[model samples]
Target: MSDTSDRLLGETTNERRASCQVAPGLTFTKIESTLQDGQTRYVRVLSVDFAAFTGKIRATTGKTVKDRERTSDMAGLMASQGLEPLAAVNGGFFDIASEFSPGALGGLTVADGKILNSAANGEAALTLGNHGTNLWIDKVWSQSRITFTPPGGSPSRPDHVVDGLNREPGRIQGCGGGMGPAGENDRNSHPDNLIDARMPQLGIHCLDSDETIVFTEDFGALPFLPGTVRAVLVGADRTVKQVSDTTSGLVAGPGEHVVVATGSHAAWLQTDAVVGSQMSLPAADVRRGASAETAVYFNGTDDAVVNGGPWLVKNGAEGPFDFNSGTTPEHAYLTPMNSRTAAGITTDRKLLLVVVDKKSGPAGPAHGLTMPQLAQAMKNLGATEAVNLDGGGSSTMWVKGALANHPSDGTGEERYVGNAIVVTAK
Candidate 1:
């Protein structure tokens, strides 16, 4: 942003007394502004000059789908994987209830080119593909299909279609895809279920009598659910190792995954799955207004993709990014003034991460920002395009393995989040 705009925010670039360089190309700035109403707003901003930066930015999830933790935990996990965590911020919205795999990512999330979850309708995503330099903030959607090829059968025409990946069989979290024949109360049917399904009356926990769900090693262990559930262990080489109808938790080994099914879906696993046949989840099928070229690009292995919503800025302008209020029930939640986290890309091609702190207590001075306020803030901060990430108690920022923002959680502590976008030295 220009020096004049910096002055407008009550801070100047030349006088970055509250800013520090977290890494060679990453800088963190803290802004404390007092409005005309005399309310204090705390904001943290992180900028990464990917164009010349010698670092890597990636999205990561906990070891399992049900795993949730602070941004530091997610960062430390990646640290064990040989990456030097430099900075991080909480990622997408997620399921917090126990029945639907509490930490299941709410929408499409691809980390290290692996599809962790399917896309949710009326949601926007930030995709960093074609290397970290090509950052995109758009209303993108995708579909995933798992095809099982019989022994000696061609992939072009698979024998059967698997239902989902890394999620519960009958529960479609965030009211998105993975709605099997018996899956109930999803957005497709009960439109209000888009967000209201999290409530008991919406029938979201309804189980599919016949469904197939593939759980990768990232999912940790297959929980032993009630019913006549059958499972087939598939190795990293795409070979079926074993098939059984057991109600026991089976931990998938490194580079291994298990396919669990019930009812007719299980029948295919019992009868058609030859021990040495190939079972695969091909590239996610890109759809919902995305161009054919965009589909091909997204399906290919790239960098990271994180889902968010209510576009803050687009194409260097304020948003026309509307998720029809008439149909999408979650629209009402976007306008309120609340603590928020957002990811953006500047016109000069820099990655921007922002976190706005909220009121801490009853008499707290911080009141947070409304959606329009956030959009203006992003544009004022030099963002050409941006999308809001998970906020409220889930809003957090970590630098050098330490908390960098005052979270709105009443306790002022970081909340266990579903995922995170982190940076590491090259």
Candidate 2:
């Protein structure tokens, strides 16, 4: 840890009321009030200033679906890494009812600087940089693609990017890769969702400039290999210049960045990707999903972004919304439903995570806020820009190793989820 990280980890300010230094530049504020309806609501807001601490603030997905840990149990995950759980909230949408749904199952998911799953166009998404710095929220118009070039040819950006990194966890609870997990191909087989047939399951496998694959399978049946996988090589040109069917070790030259994708091949092979020749993947056409567009998320070397709908607040102005539209937005941006979650950046360039708690039951106080109310609440909090995240029963927050709110699941339990935005002091 640098001086900044040290200062942030060690600094404690006890002078504030209902607020304290949860992390370096991070502050926790709780707002409690009783409404005229005799309902009491609880709101815990995390305020972060990027300047104080010296580490990283990230939105990371948990283990793949089959081997998933309870997302509401942020403390357990934090303990596994020997980290302090500053705060955490569920992430993205997924095949909630399926046991075989893969981890980071749906929406756009990029963890630890790797693009594990691309966003669907029209869907909302959040993108981030590798260092967990640059942050963006926007409406994703493109899913994902692979553009590559051979030894010497105009950039050959392929039309398709690999669909995923593994089998659907919702479809097959223990669909491990290799000959061991026989149904790996059978789970979640779609034309769009894909994993390399040879690699077994799908995932984002990283490689350094030297083309050294740095990944080890945690749950899937596939064994870890340095270069042999569904890997794409990014070179000095910063463009993916090559795609390999079986192994990145064969395609990547020394000193190149590598990325490996996993998913079912039944869906991915639809792209007709090639390797011997030159190729480059251009942004694919944006497709609309059942309710809205599928979102995209990315972790670049220096920025992060997630997008959905028109800007809620930018430069301190509310963009647009219709409280009485009598209909939900395509992606439910302004839904009046309760248990809404929002991520934002303050005008002063700080990070904000807000979860509006809904009244748990007839006896609970806060029922949660609607679209317009949620947006306005963000504005009042001084958020210059923000975007809505998956909520409803998915809306739960964890701090210091415990759920900080009443989960609407009624089971008094954390919903087992595909992914989560985990903030840590590591």
Candidate 3:
């Protein structure tokens, strides 16, 4: 075993002995946190076992070739030492390559004279343009349903929301695409509250009472939507439910307007619902007197967000919520192509989530996390379902332009994308 592995094992053994535990179900054997760049922020390395799968977490960091190779080597070393690398196939890392090009990140041509690469892999570097932006790498996914919002921008605007719900009715069971034009075509069909020139606004929040809610707006107006509204509510006990203007006694239709709700315990709200409300308050209040806008309130019942009976809330607010941190103003987000299923050796588990943050440092082969490292990072987070988010120069996450993760290209540029994930009010 390599020195690192040996030390990790020794540490695990010592921890087990000290804890005086017998047959612990799942435990962390090793944890290594480091700051690669000159910045104070560092990435965390955790070696964990869930009694089913074992892996490590890479915390938050930019992509780098050396880091990627090192991560791959580590996976190999783990396998050779009798430790199964959960997602690593045959002791080798598995990467989701872009279908747009062979071994190349997915690319797109934007309305402006710019080229956007939304499906870049961990092995590639990001390049920013004068007006171009990169995508983010942080994401959260569940079975066939996924939601991701963009990062960093003005207030009262959506980050970006993408959801993949099953469309077919038991056709393939738990297999479908995003919730929108695609979702409308699928079996798990759900109404899209907002649809217009502008994309829909997406936001998540938790009430002081320990309930989670996700909000979406109409998509008729660019930068603004009409009277459409939809929401997903979650309880403090990790129970999910749905809440909307319909349930809140608010007038629902189709037009561009802001929506707001109030609660406590900031993280209780999923994403940046606080930020979304902050943005929508003034504008929405102006459009409709305190009476009309206020009418759309969050009713106490948090059972509307439940999927199948009850499941632990997977994506909640806890990580970086603000876009205007040290990261860039642009963030890349991801969603699943379809829901997952079990088909022989291949599981239909598609990761549908969004991660948007700015490119922090310079761009090049030495930036960001490699495919292997990313997988390890997910494993460390105890993620049973995870996938590579949009990356490369198009890999950008921003809060009003404050860079987050290290940029693959040092130019501090924003790459265009087919679409983005933004957090906004109802």
Candidate 4:
């Protein structure tokens, strides 16, 4: 790494620490401490200084629901792709259980500039430019759309909005997307307990009667069994190849996409989307809450993005929790002390992957940390902006060729996550 003294948080100080340089610009550090309450805390951080780092820090997601992989497995996959795996941590929240299709992430996700999934409302996500040079943490919104024109139809007609990319239609996992006329955020086909005010409509399978979802080759084959859902298959040439109501044995071929719709949307396809019609699927439009610039720059721009929330710290302090009134007893989601994984960027532009170990075994004395505590920890580590990633049993850290933290999973095994943020050197 660059000067170790300058990069670290001053190791010679009061905390017990173990540090190692994983690569030219990557360093892994572990801090062990006993809180005033006598609980032990284990904190692991993977600090990346892009100026000295020779690789890229990007997000990786599976192409299929059954493709979920452990943190180490993801690292191995990166290695197989010819990039040296330096460090990695679990990504955003996802639908671990879904009656339709499991593993649909809760928020926006992009890998190597390709939009894997759009944002979940205006959820906070940690965005990074190629080579980890540019980074932004903010609430973002995005949507995919398709345009089709008949032989004699006007080309100026409006484009049809795509509800989701490569995911089950209408069955929103995390309840994202903008509110509709009825103030419905997403169709909640499987609403369970109210996770919190921020996620009242959240569930494993939020259903919508009429919606459109686009499926690309990235999703592998169509993930649905026998169902009433209808789809329009479009070739790379932008021609409608076929329209089928059959949900079985269907897959989007190379440079092709399948537009799957339900209810009235299906009817629109059966009519307007007849065989031989012209169609075009453009890059998704994404916008950051704080910027007027088109967030679509994130698509295919050599940048990497991953989903996370709510904001732990913004501009060097605890940020706003507009979705939840932290003072209310009903909003207990952020108050509990739980194992946490957070992604942050320092004022100087250095990237930080922070993982807090919960008291899963006798060796780990830390009972985890509350959201506020996690924010304070990120601030203490010099992060001017940060957001919490998927944690709990999913919180994991892999570095220097192996798992580096005690996964809070009771058995100590890492969970198969929807995605991960990894540092790799080509």
Considering every candidate listed, which one attains the maximal lDDT?
4
Q: Candidate 4 lDDT, tens digit per residue, 190-245?
A: 44534432232222235566788887777676755444567888998999888888
Write the residue-wise lDDT of candidate 3 on 1-426 in tens digits.
112332211212211111111122212122222224422211212121223222221111112100122223333344454544322110011112212111111211111111111110111111111211121112111211122221353323243222211010011111122222222322222134221201111111001111112222211111211233233332322223333432232221222222222222122223433222322211110011111121111122110110110011113211231221111113222121111100000022212222212224232222234333343344334444333333444343322123223333345544322222211110
Which candidate tops TM-score?
A: 4
Q: What is the C-alpha lDDT of each candidate?
A: 0.69, 0.48, 0.22, 0.72
TM-score of each: 0.81, 0.60, 0.23, 0.87
- Model 2 TM-score (2 dp): 0.60
Q: Which residue pairs in candidate 1 have backbone atoms (N, alpha carbon, C) closer than 3 angstroms, thus clashing?
A: none
- Runs in model 1 deviating more than 4 A are 1-17, 129-131, 149-162, 177-188, 191-210, 262-264, 274-277, 287-293, 296-302, 324-330, 361-363
Worst 10-residue lDDT window for candidate 3 reads 303-312
Cα displacement (Å) at residue 59, model 2: 2.0
C-alpha root-mean-square deviation, each candidate:
5.3, 12.6, 21.7, 4.4
Candidate 1, residue 23: lDDT: 84
TM-score of 4: 0.87
- Model 2 has an lDDT value of 0.48
